[model samples]
Target: MASDAPADSVPALPDPVSRARLVDAVRFDRDGLVACIAQQHDTGEVLMMAWMNRTALEETLATGRVTYWSRSRAALWRKGETSGQVQRLIDLRLDCDGDTLLALVDQTGVACHTGRRSCFYRAMRGDALVALTEPEADPAELYGR
Candidate 1:
């Protein structure tokens, strides 16, 4: 996996031919977005899930960094732009239906906005919701508002 860096630190953009083939295979939703799940490439641990528009998907494929479409902000969101938890893309996979994406990445830090290693920190232990892990970093510091 490549080194993790800030959103601004994009490596050389990928070859346009390959990138175009990938972007064309995706079946975006009505909102022009696709569900993308980030997972640790080495550990196979699921990290987080986010939405990606064509721009974000193109950027990520070209730069080798995970990028997402922020629905609330209605803008492209480069991972680790505000928080220092960048995810460097090692590989990306499209579902059979091309409606979902799986990003194999090298995670720099916590993946959750709540400062946990993964967004899936909660579980239904029996009939009750439970938190399986503790926050590894402070939420306040993670966002660095």
Candidate 2:
């Protein structure tokens, strides 16, 4: 979820001590990335799931915007950079195991790359996969052909 505020004006993060503690609490996978579940802060809707490395988590904390490490691109990706469907971080939570992350965010637009509200738009019914919703916008239109 995104805010109307400018991206550069995000609030300052906690001090170094607190930041260090927070970072140290997380346990990354072999690839140094944790699975992050993004949910809509206000609606409590699960938007999407992504991977976040230490750098991505730190950047998100500092910027109040969600960032992820793109496995395909092998680099950091700030949400909404291309599709204008930004996610503004509201809160970050760590599971008891410290192996996963939950990010409460204010989503500005559709969360799915396919231009759907969410990536989990399909459901299994009687051993058949059924689409629960149609794309709100065309992917080609949103991301360019």
Whole-model lDDT per candidate: 0.86, 0.85
Candidate 1: worst-modelled 10 consecutive residues by lDDT: 1-10
Which residue pairs does candidate 1 place in steric collision?
A: none
Model 1, backbone clash pairs (residues 3+ apart or across chains), number: 0
Model 1 C-alpha lDDT per residue in residues 1-145, reported as the tens digit of each score = 2335443433333578888898999999999999999999999899999999999999898877788999999999988878868888888889999999998888888889989999998989999999999999998987765
Q: RMSD per prediction, one decimal?
A: 3.4, 2.6
Relative to the true structure, candidate 2 reaches a TM of 0.89
Q: After best superposition, candidate 1 residue 49: deviation in angstroms?
A: 0.9
* Candidate 1 wrong stretches, greater than 4 Å: 1-13
How much is the lDDT of residue 55 in candidate 1? 96
TM-score of 1: 0.89
For model 2, the stretches where C-alpha displacement exceeds 4 angstroms are 1-4, 7-12
Each prediction's total of clashing residue pairs, residues at least 3 apart in sequence or on different chains, is 0, 4
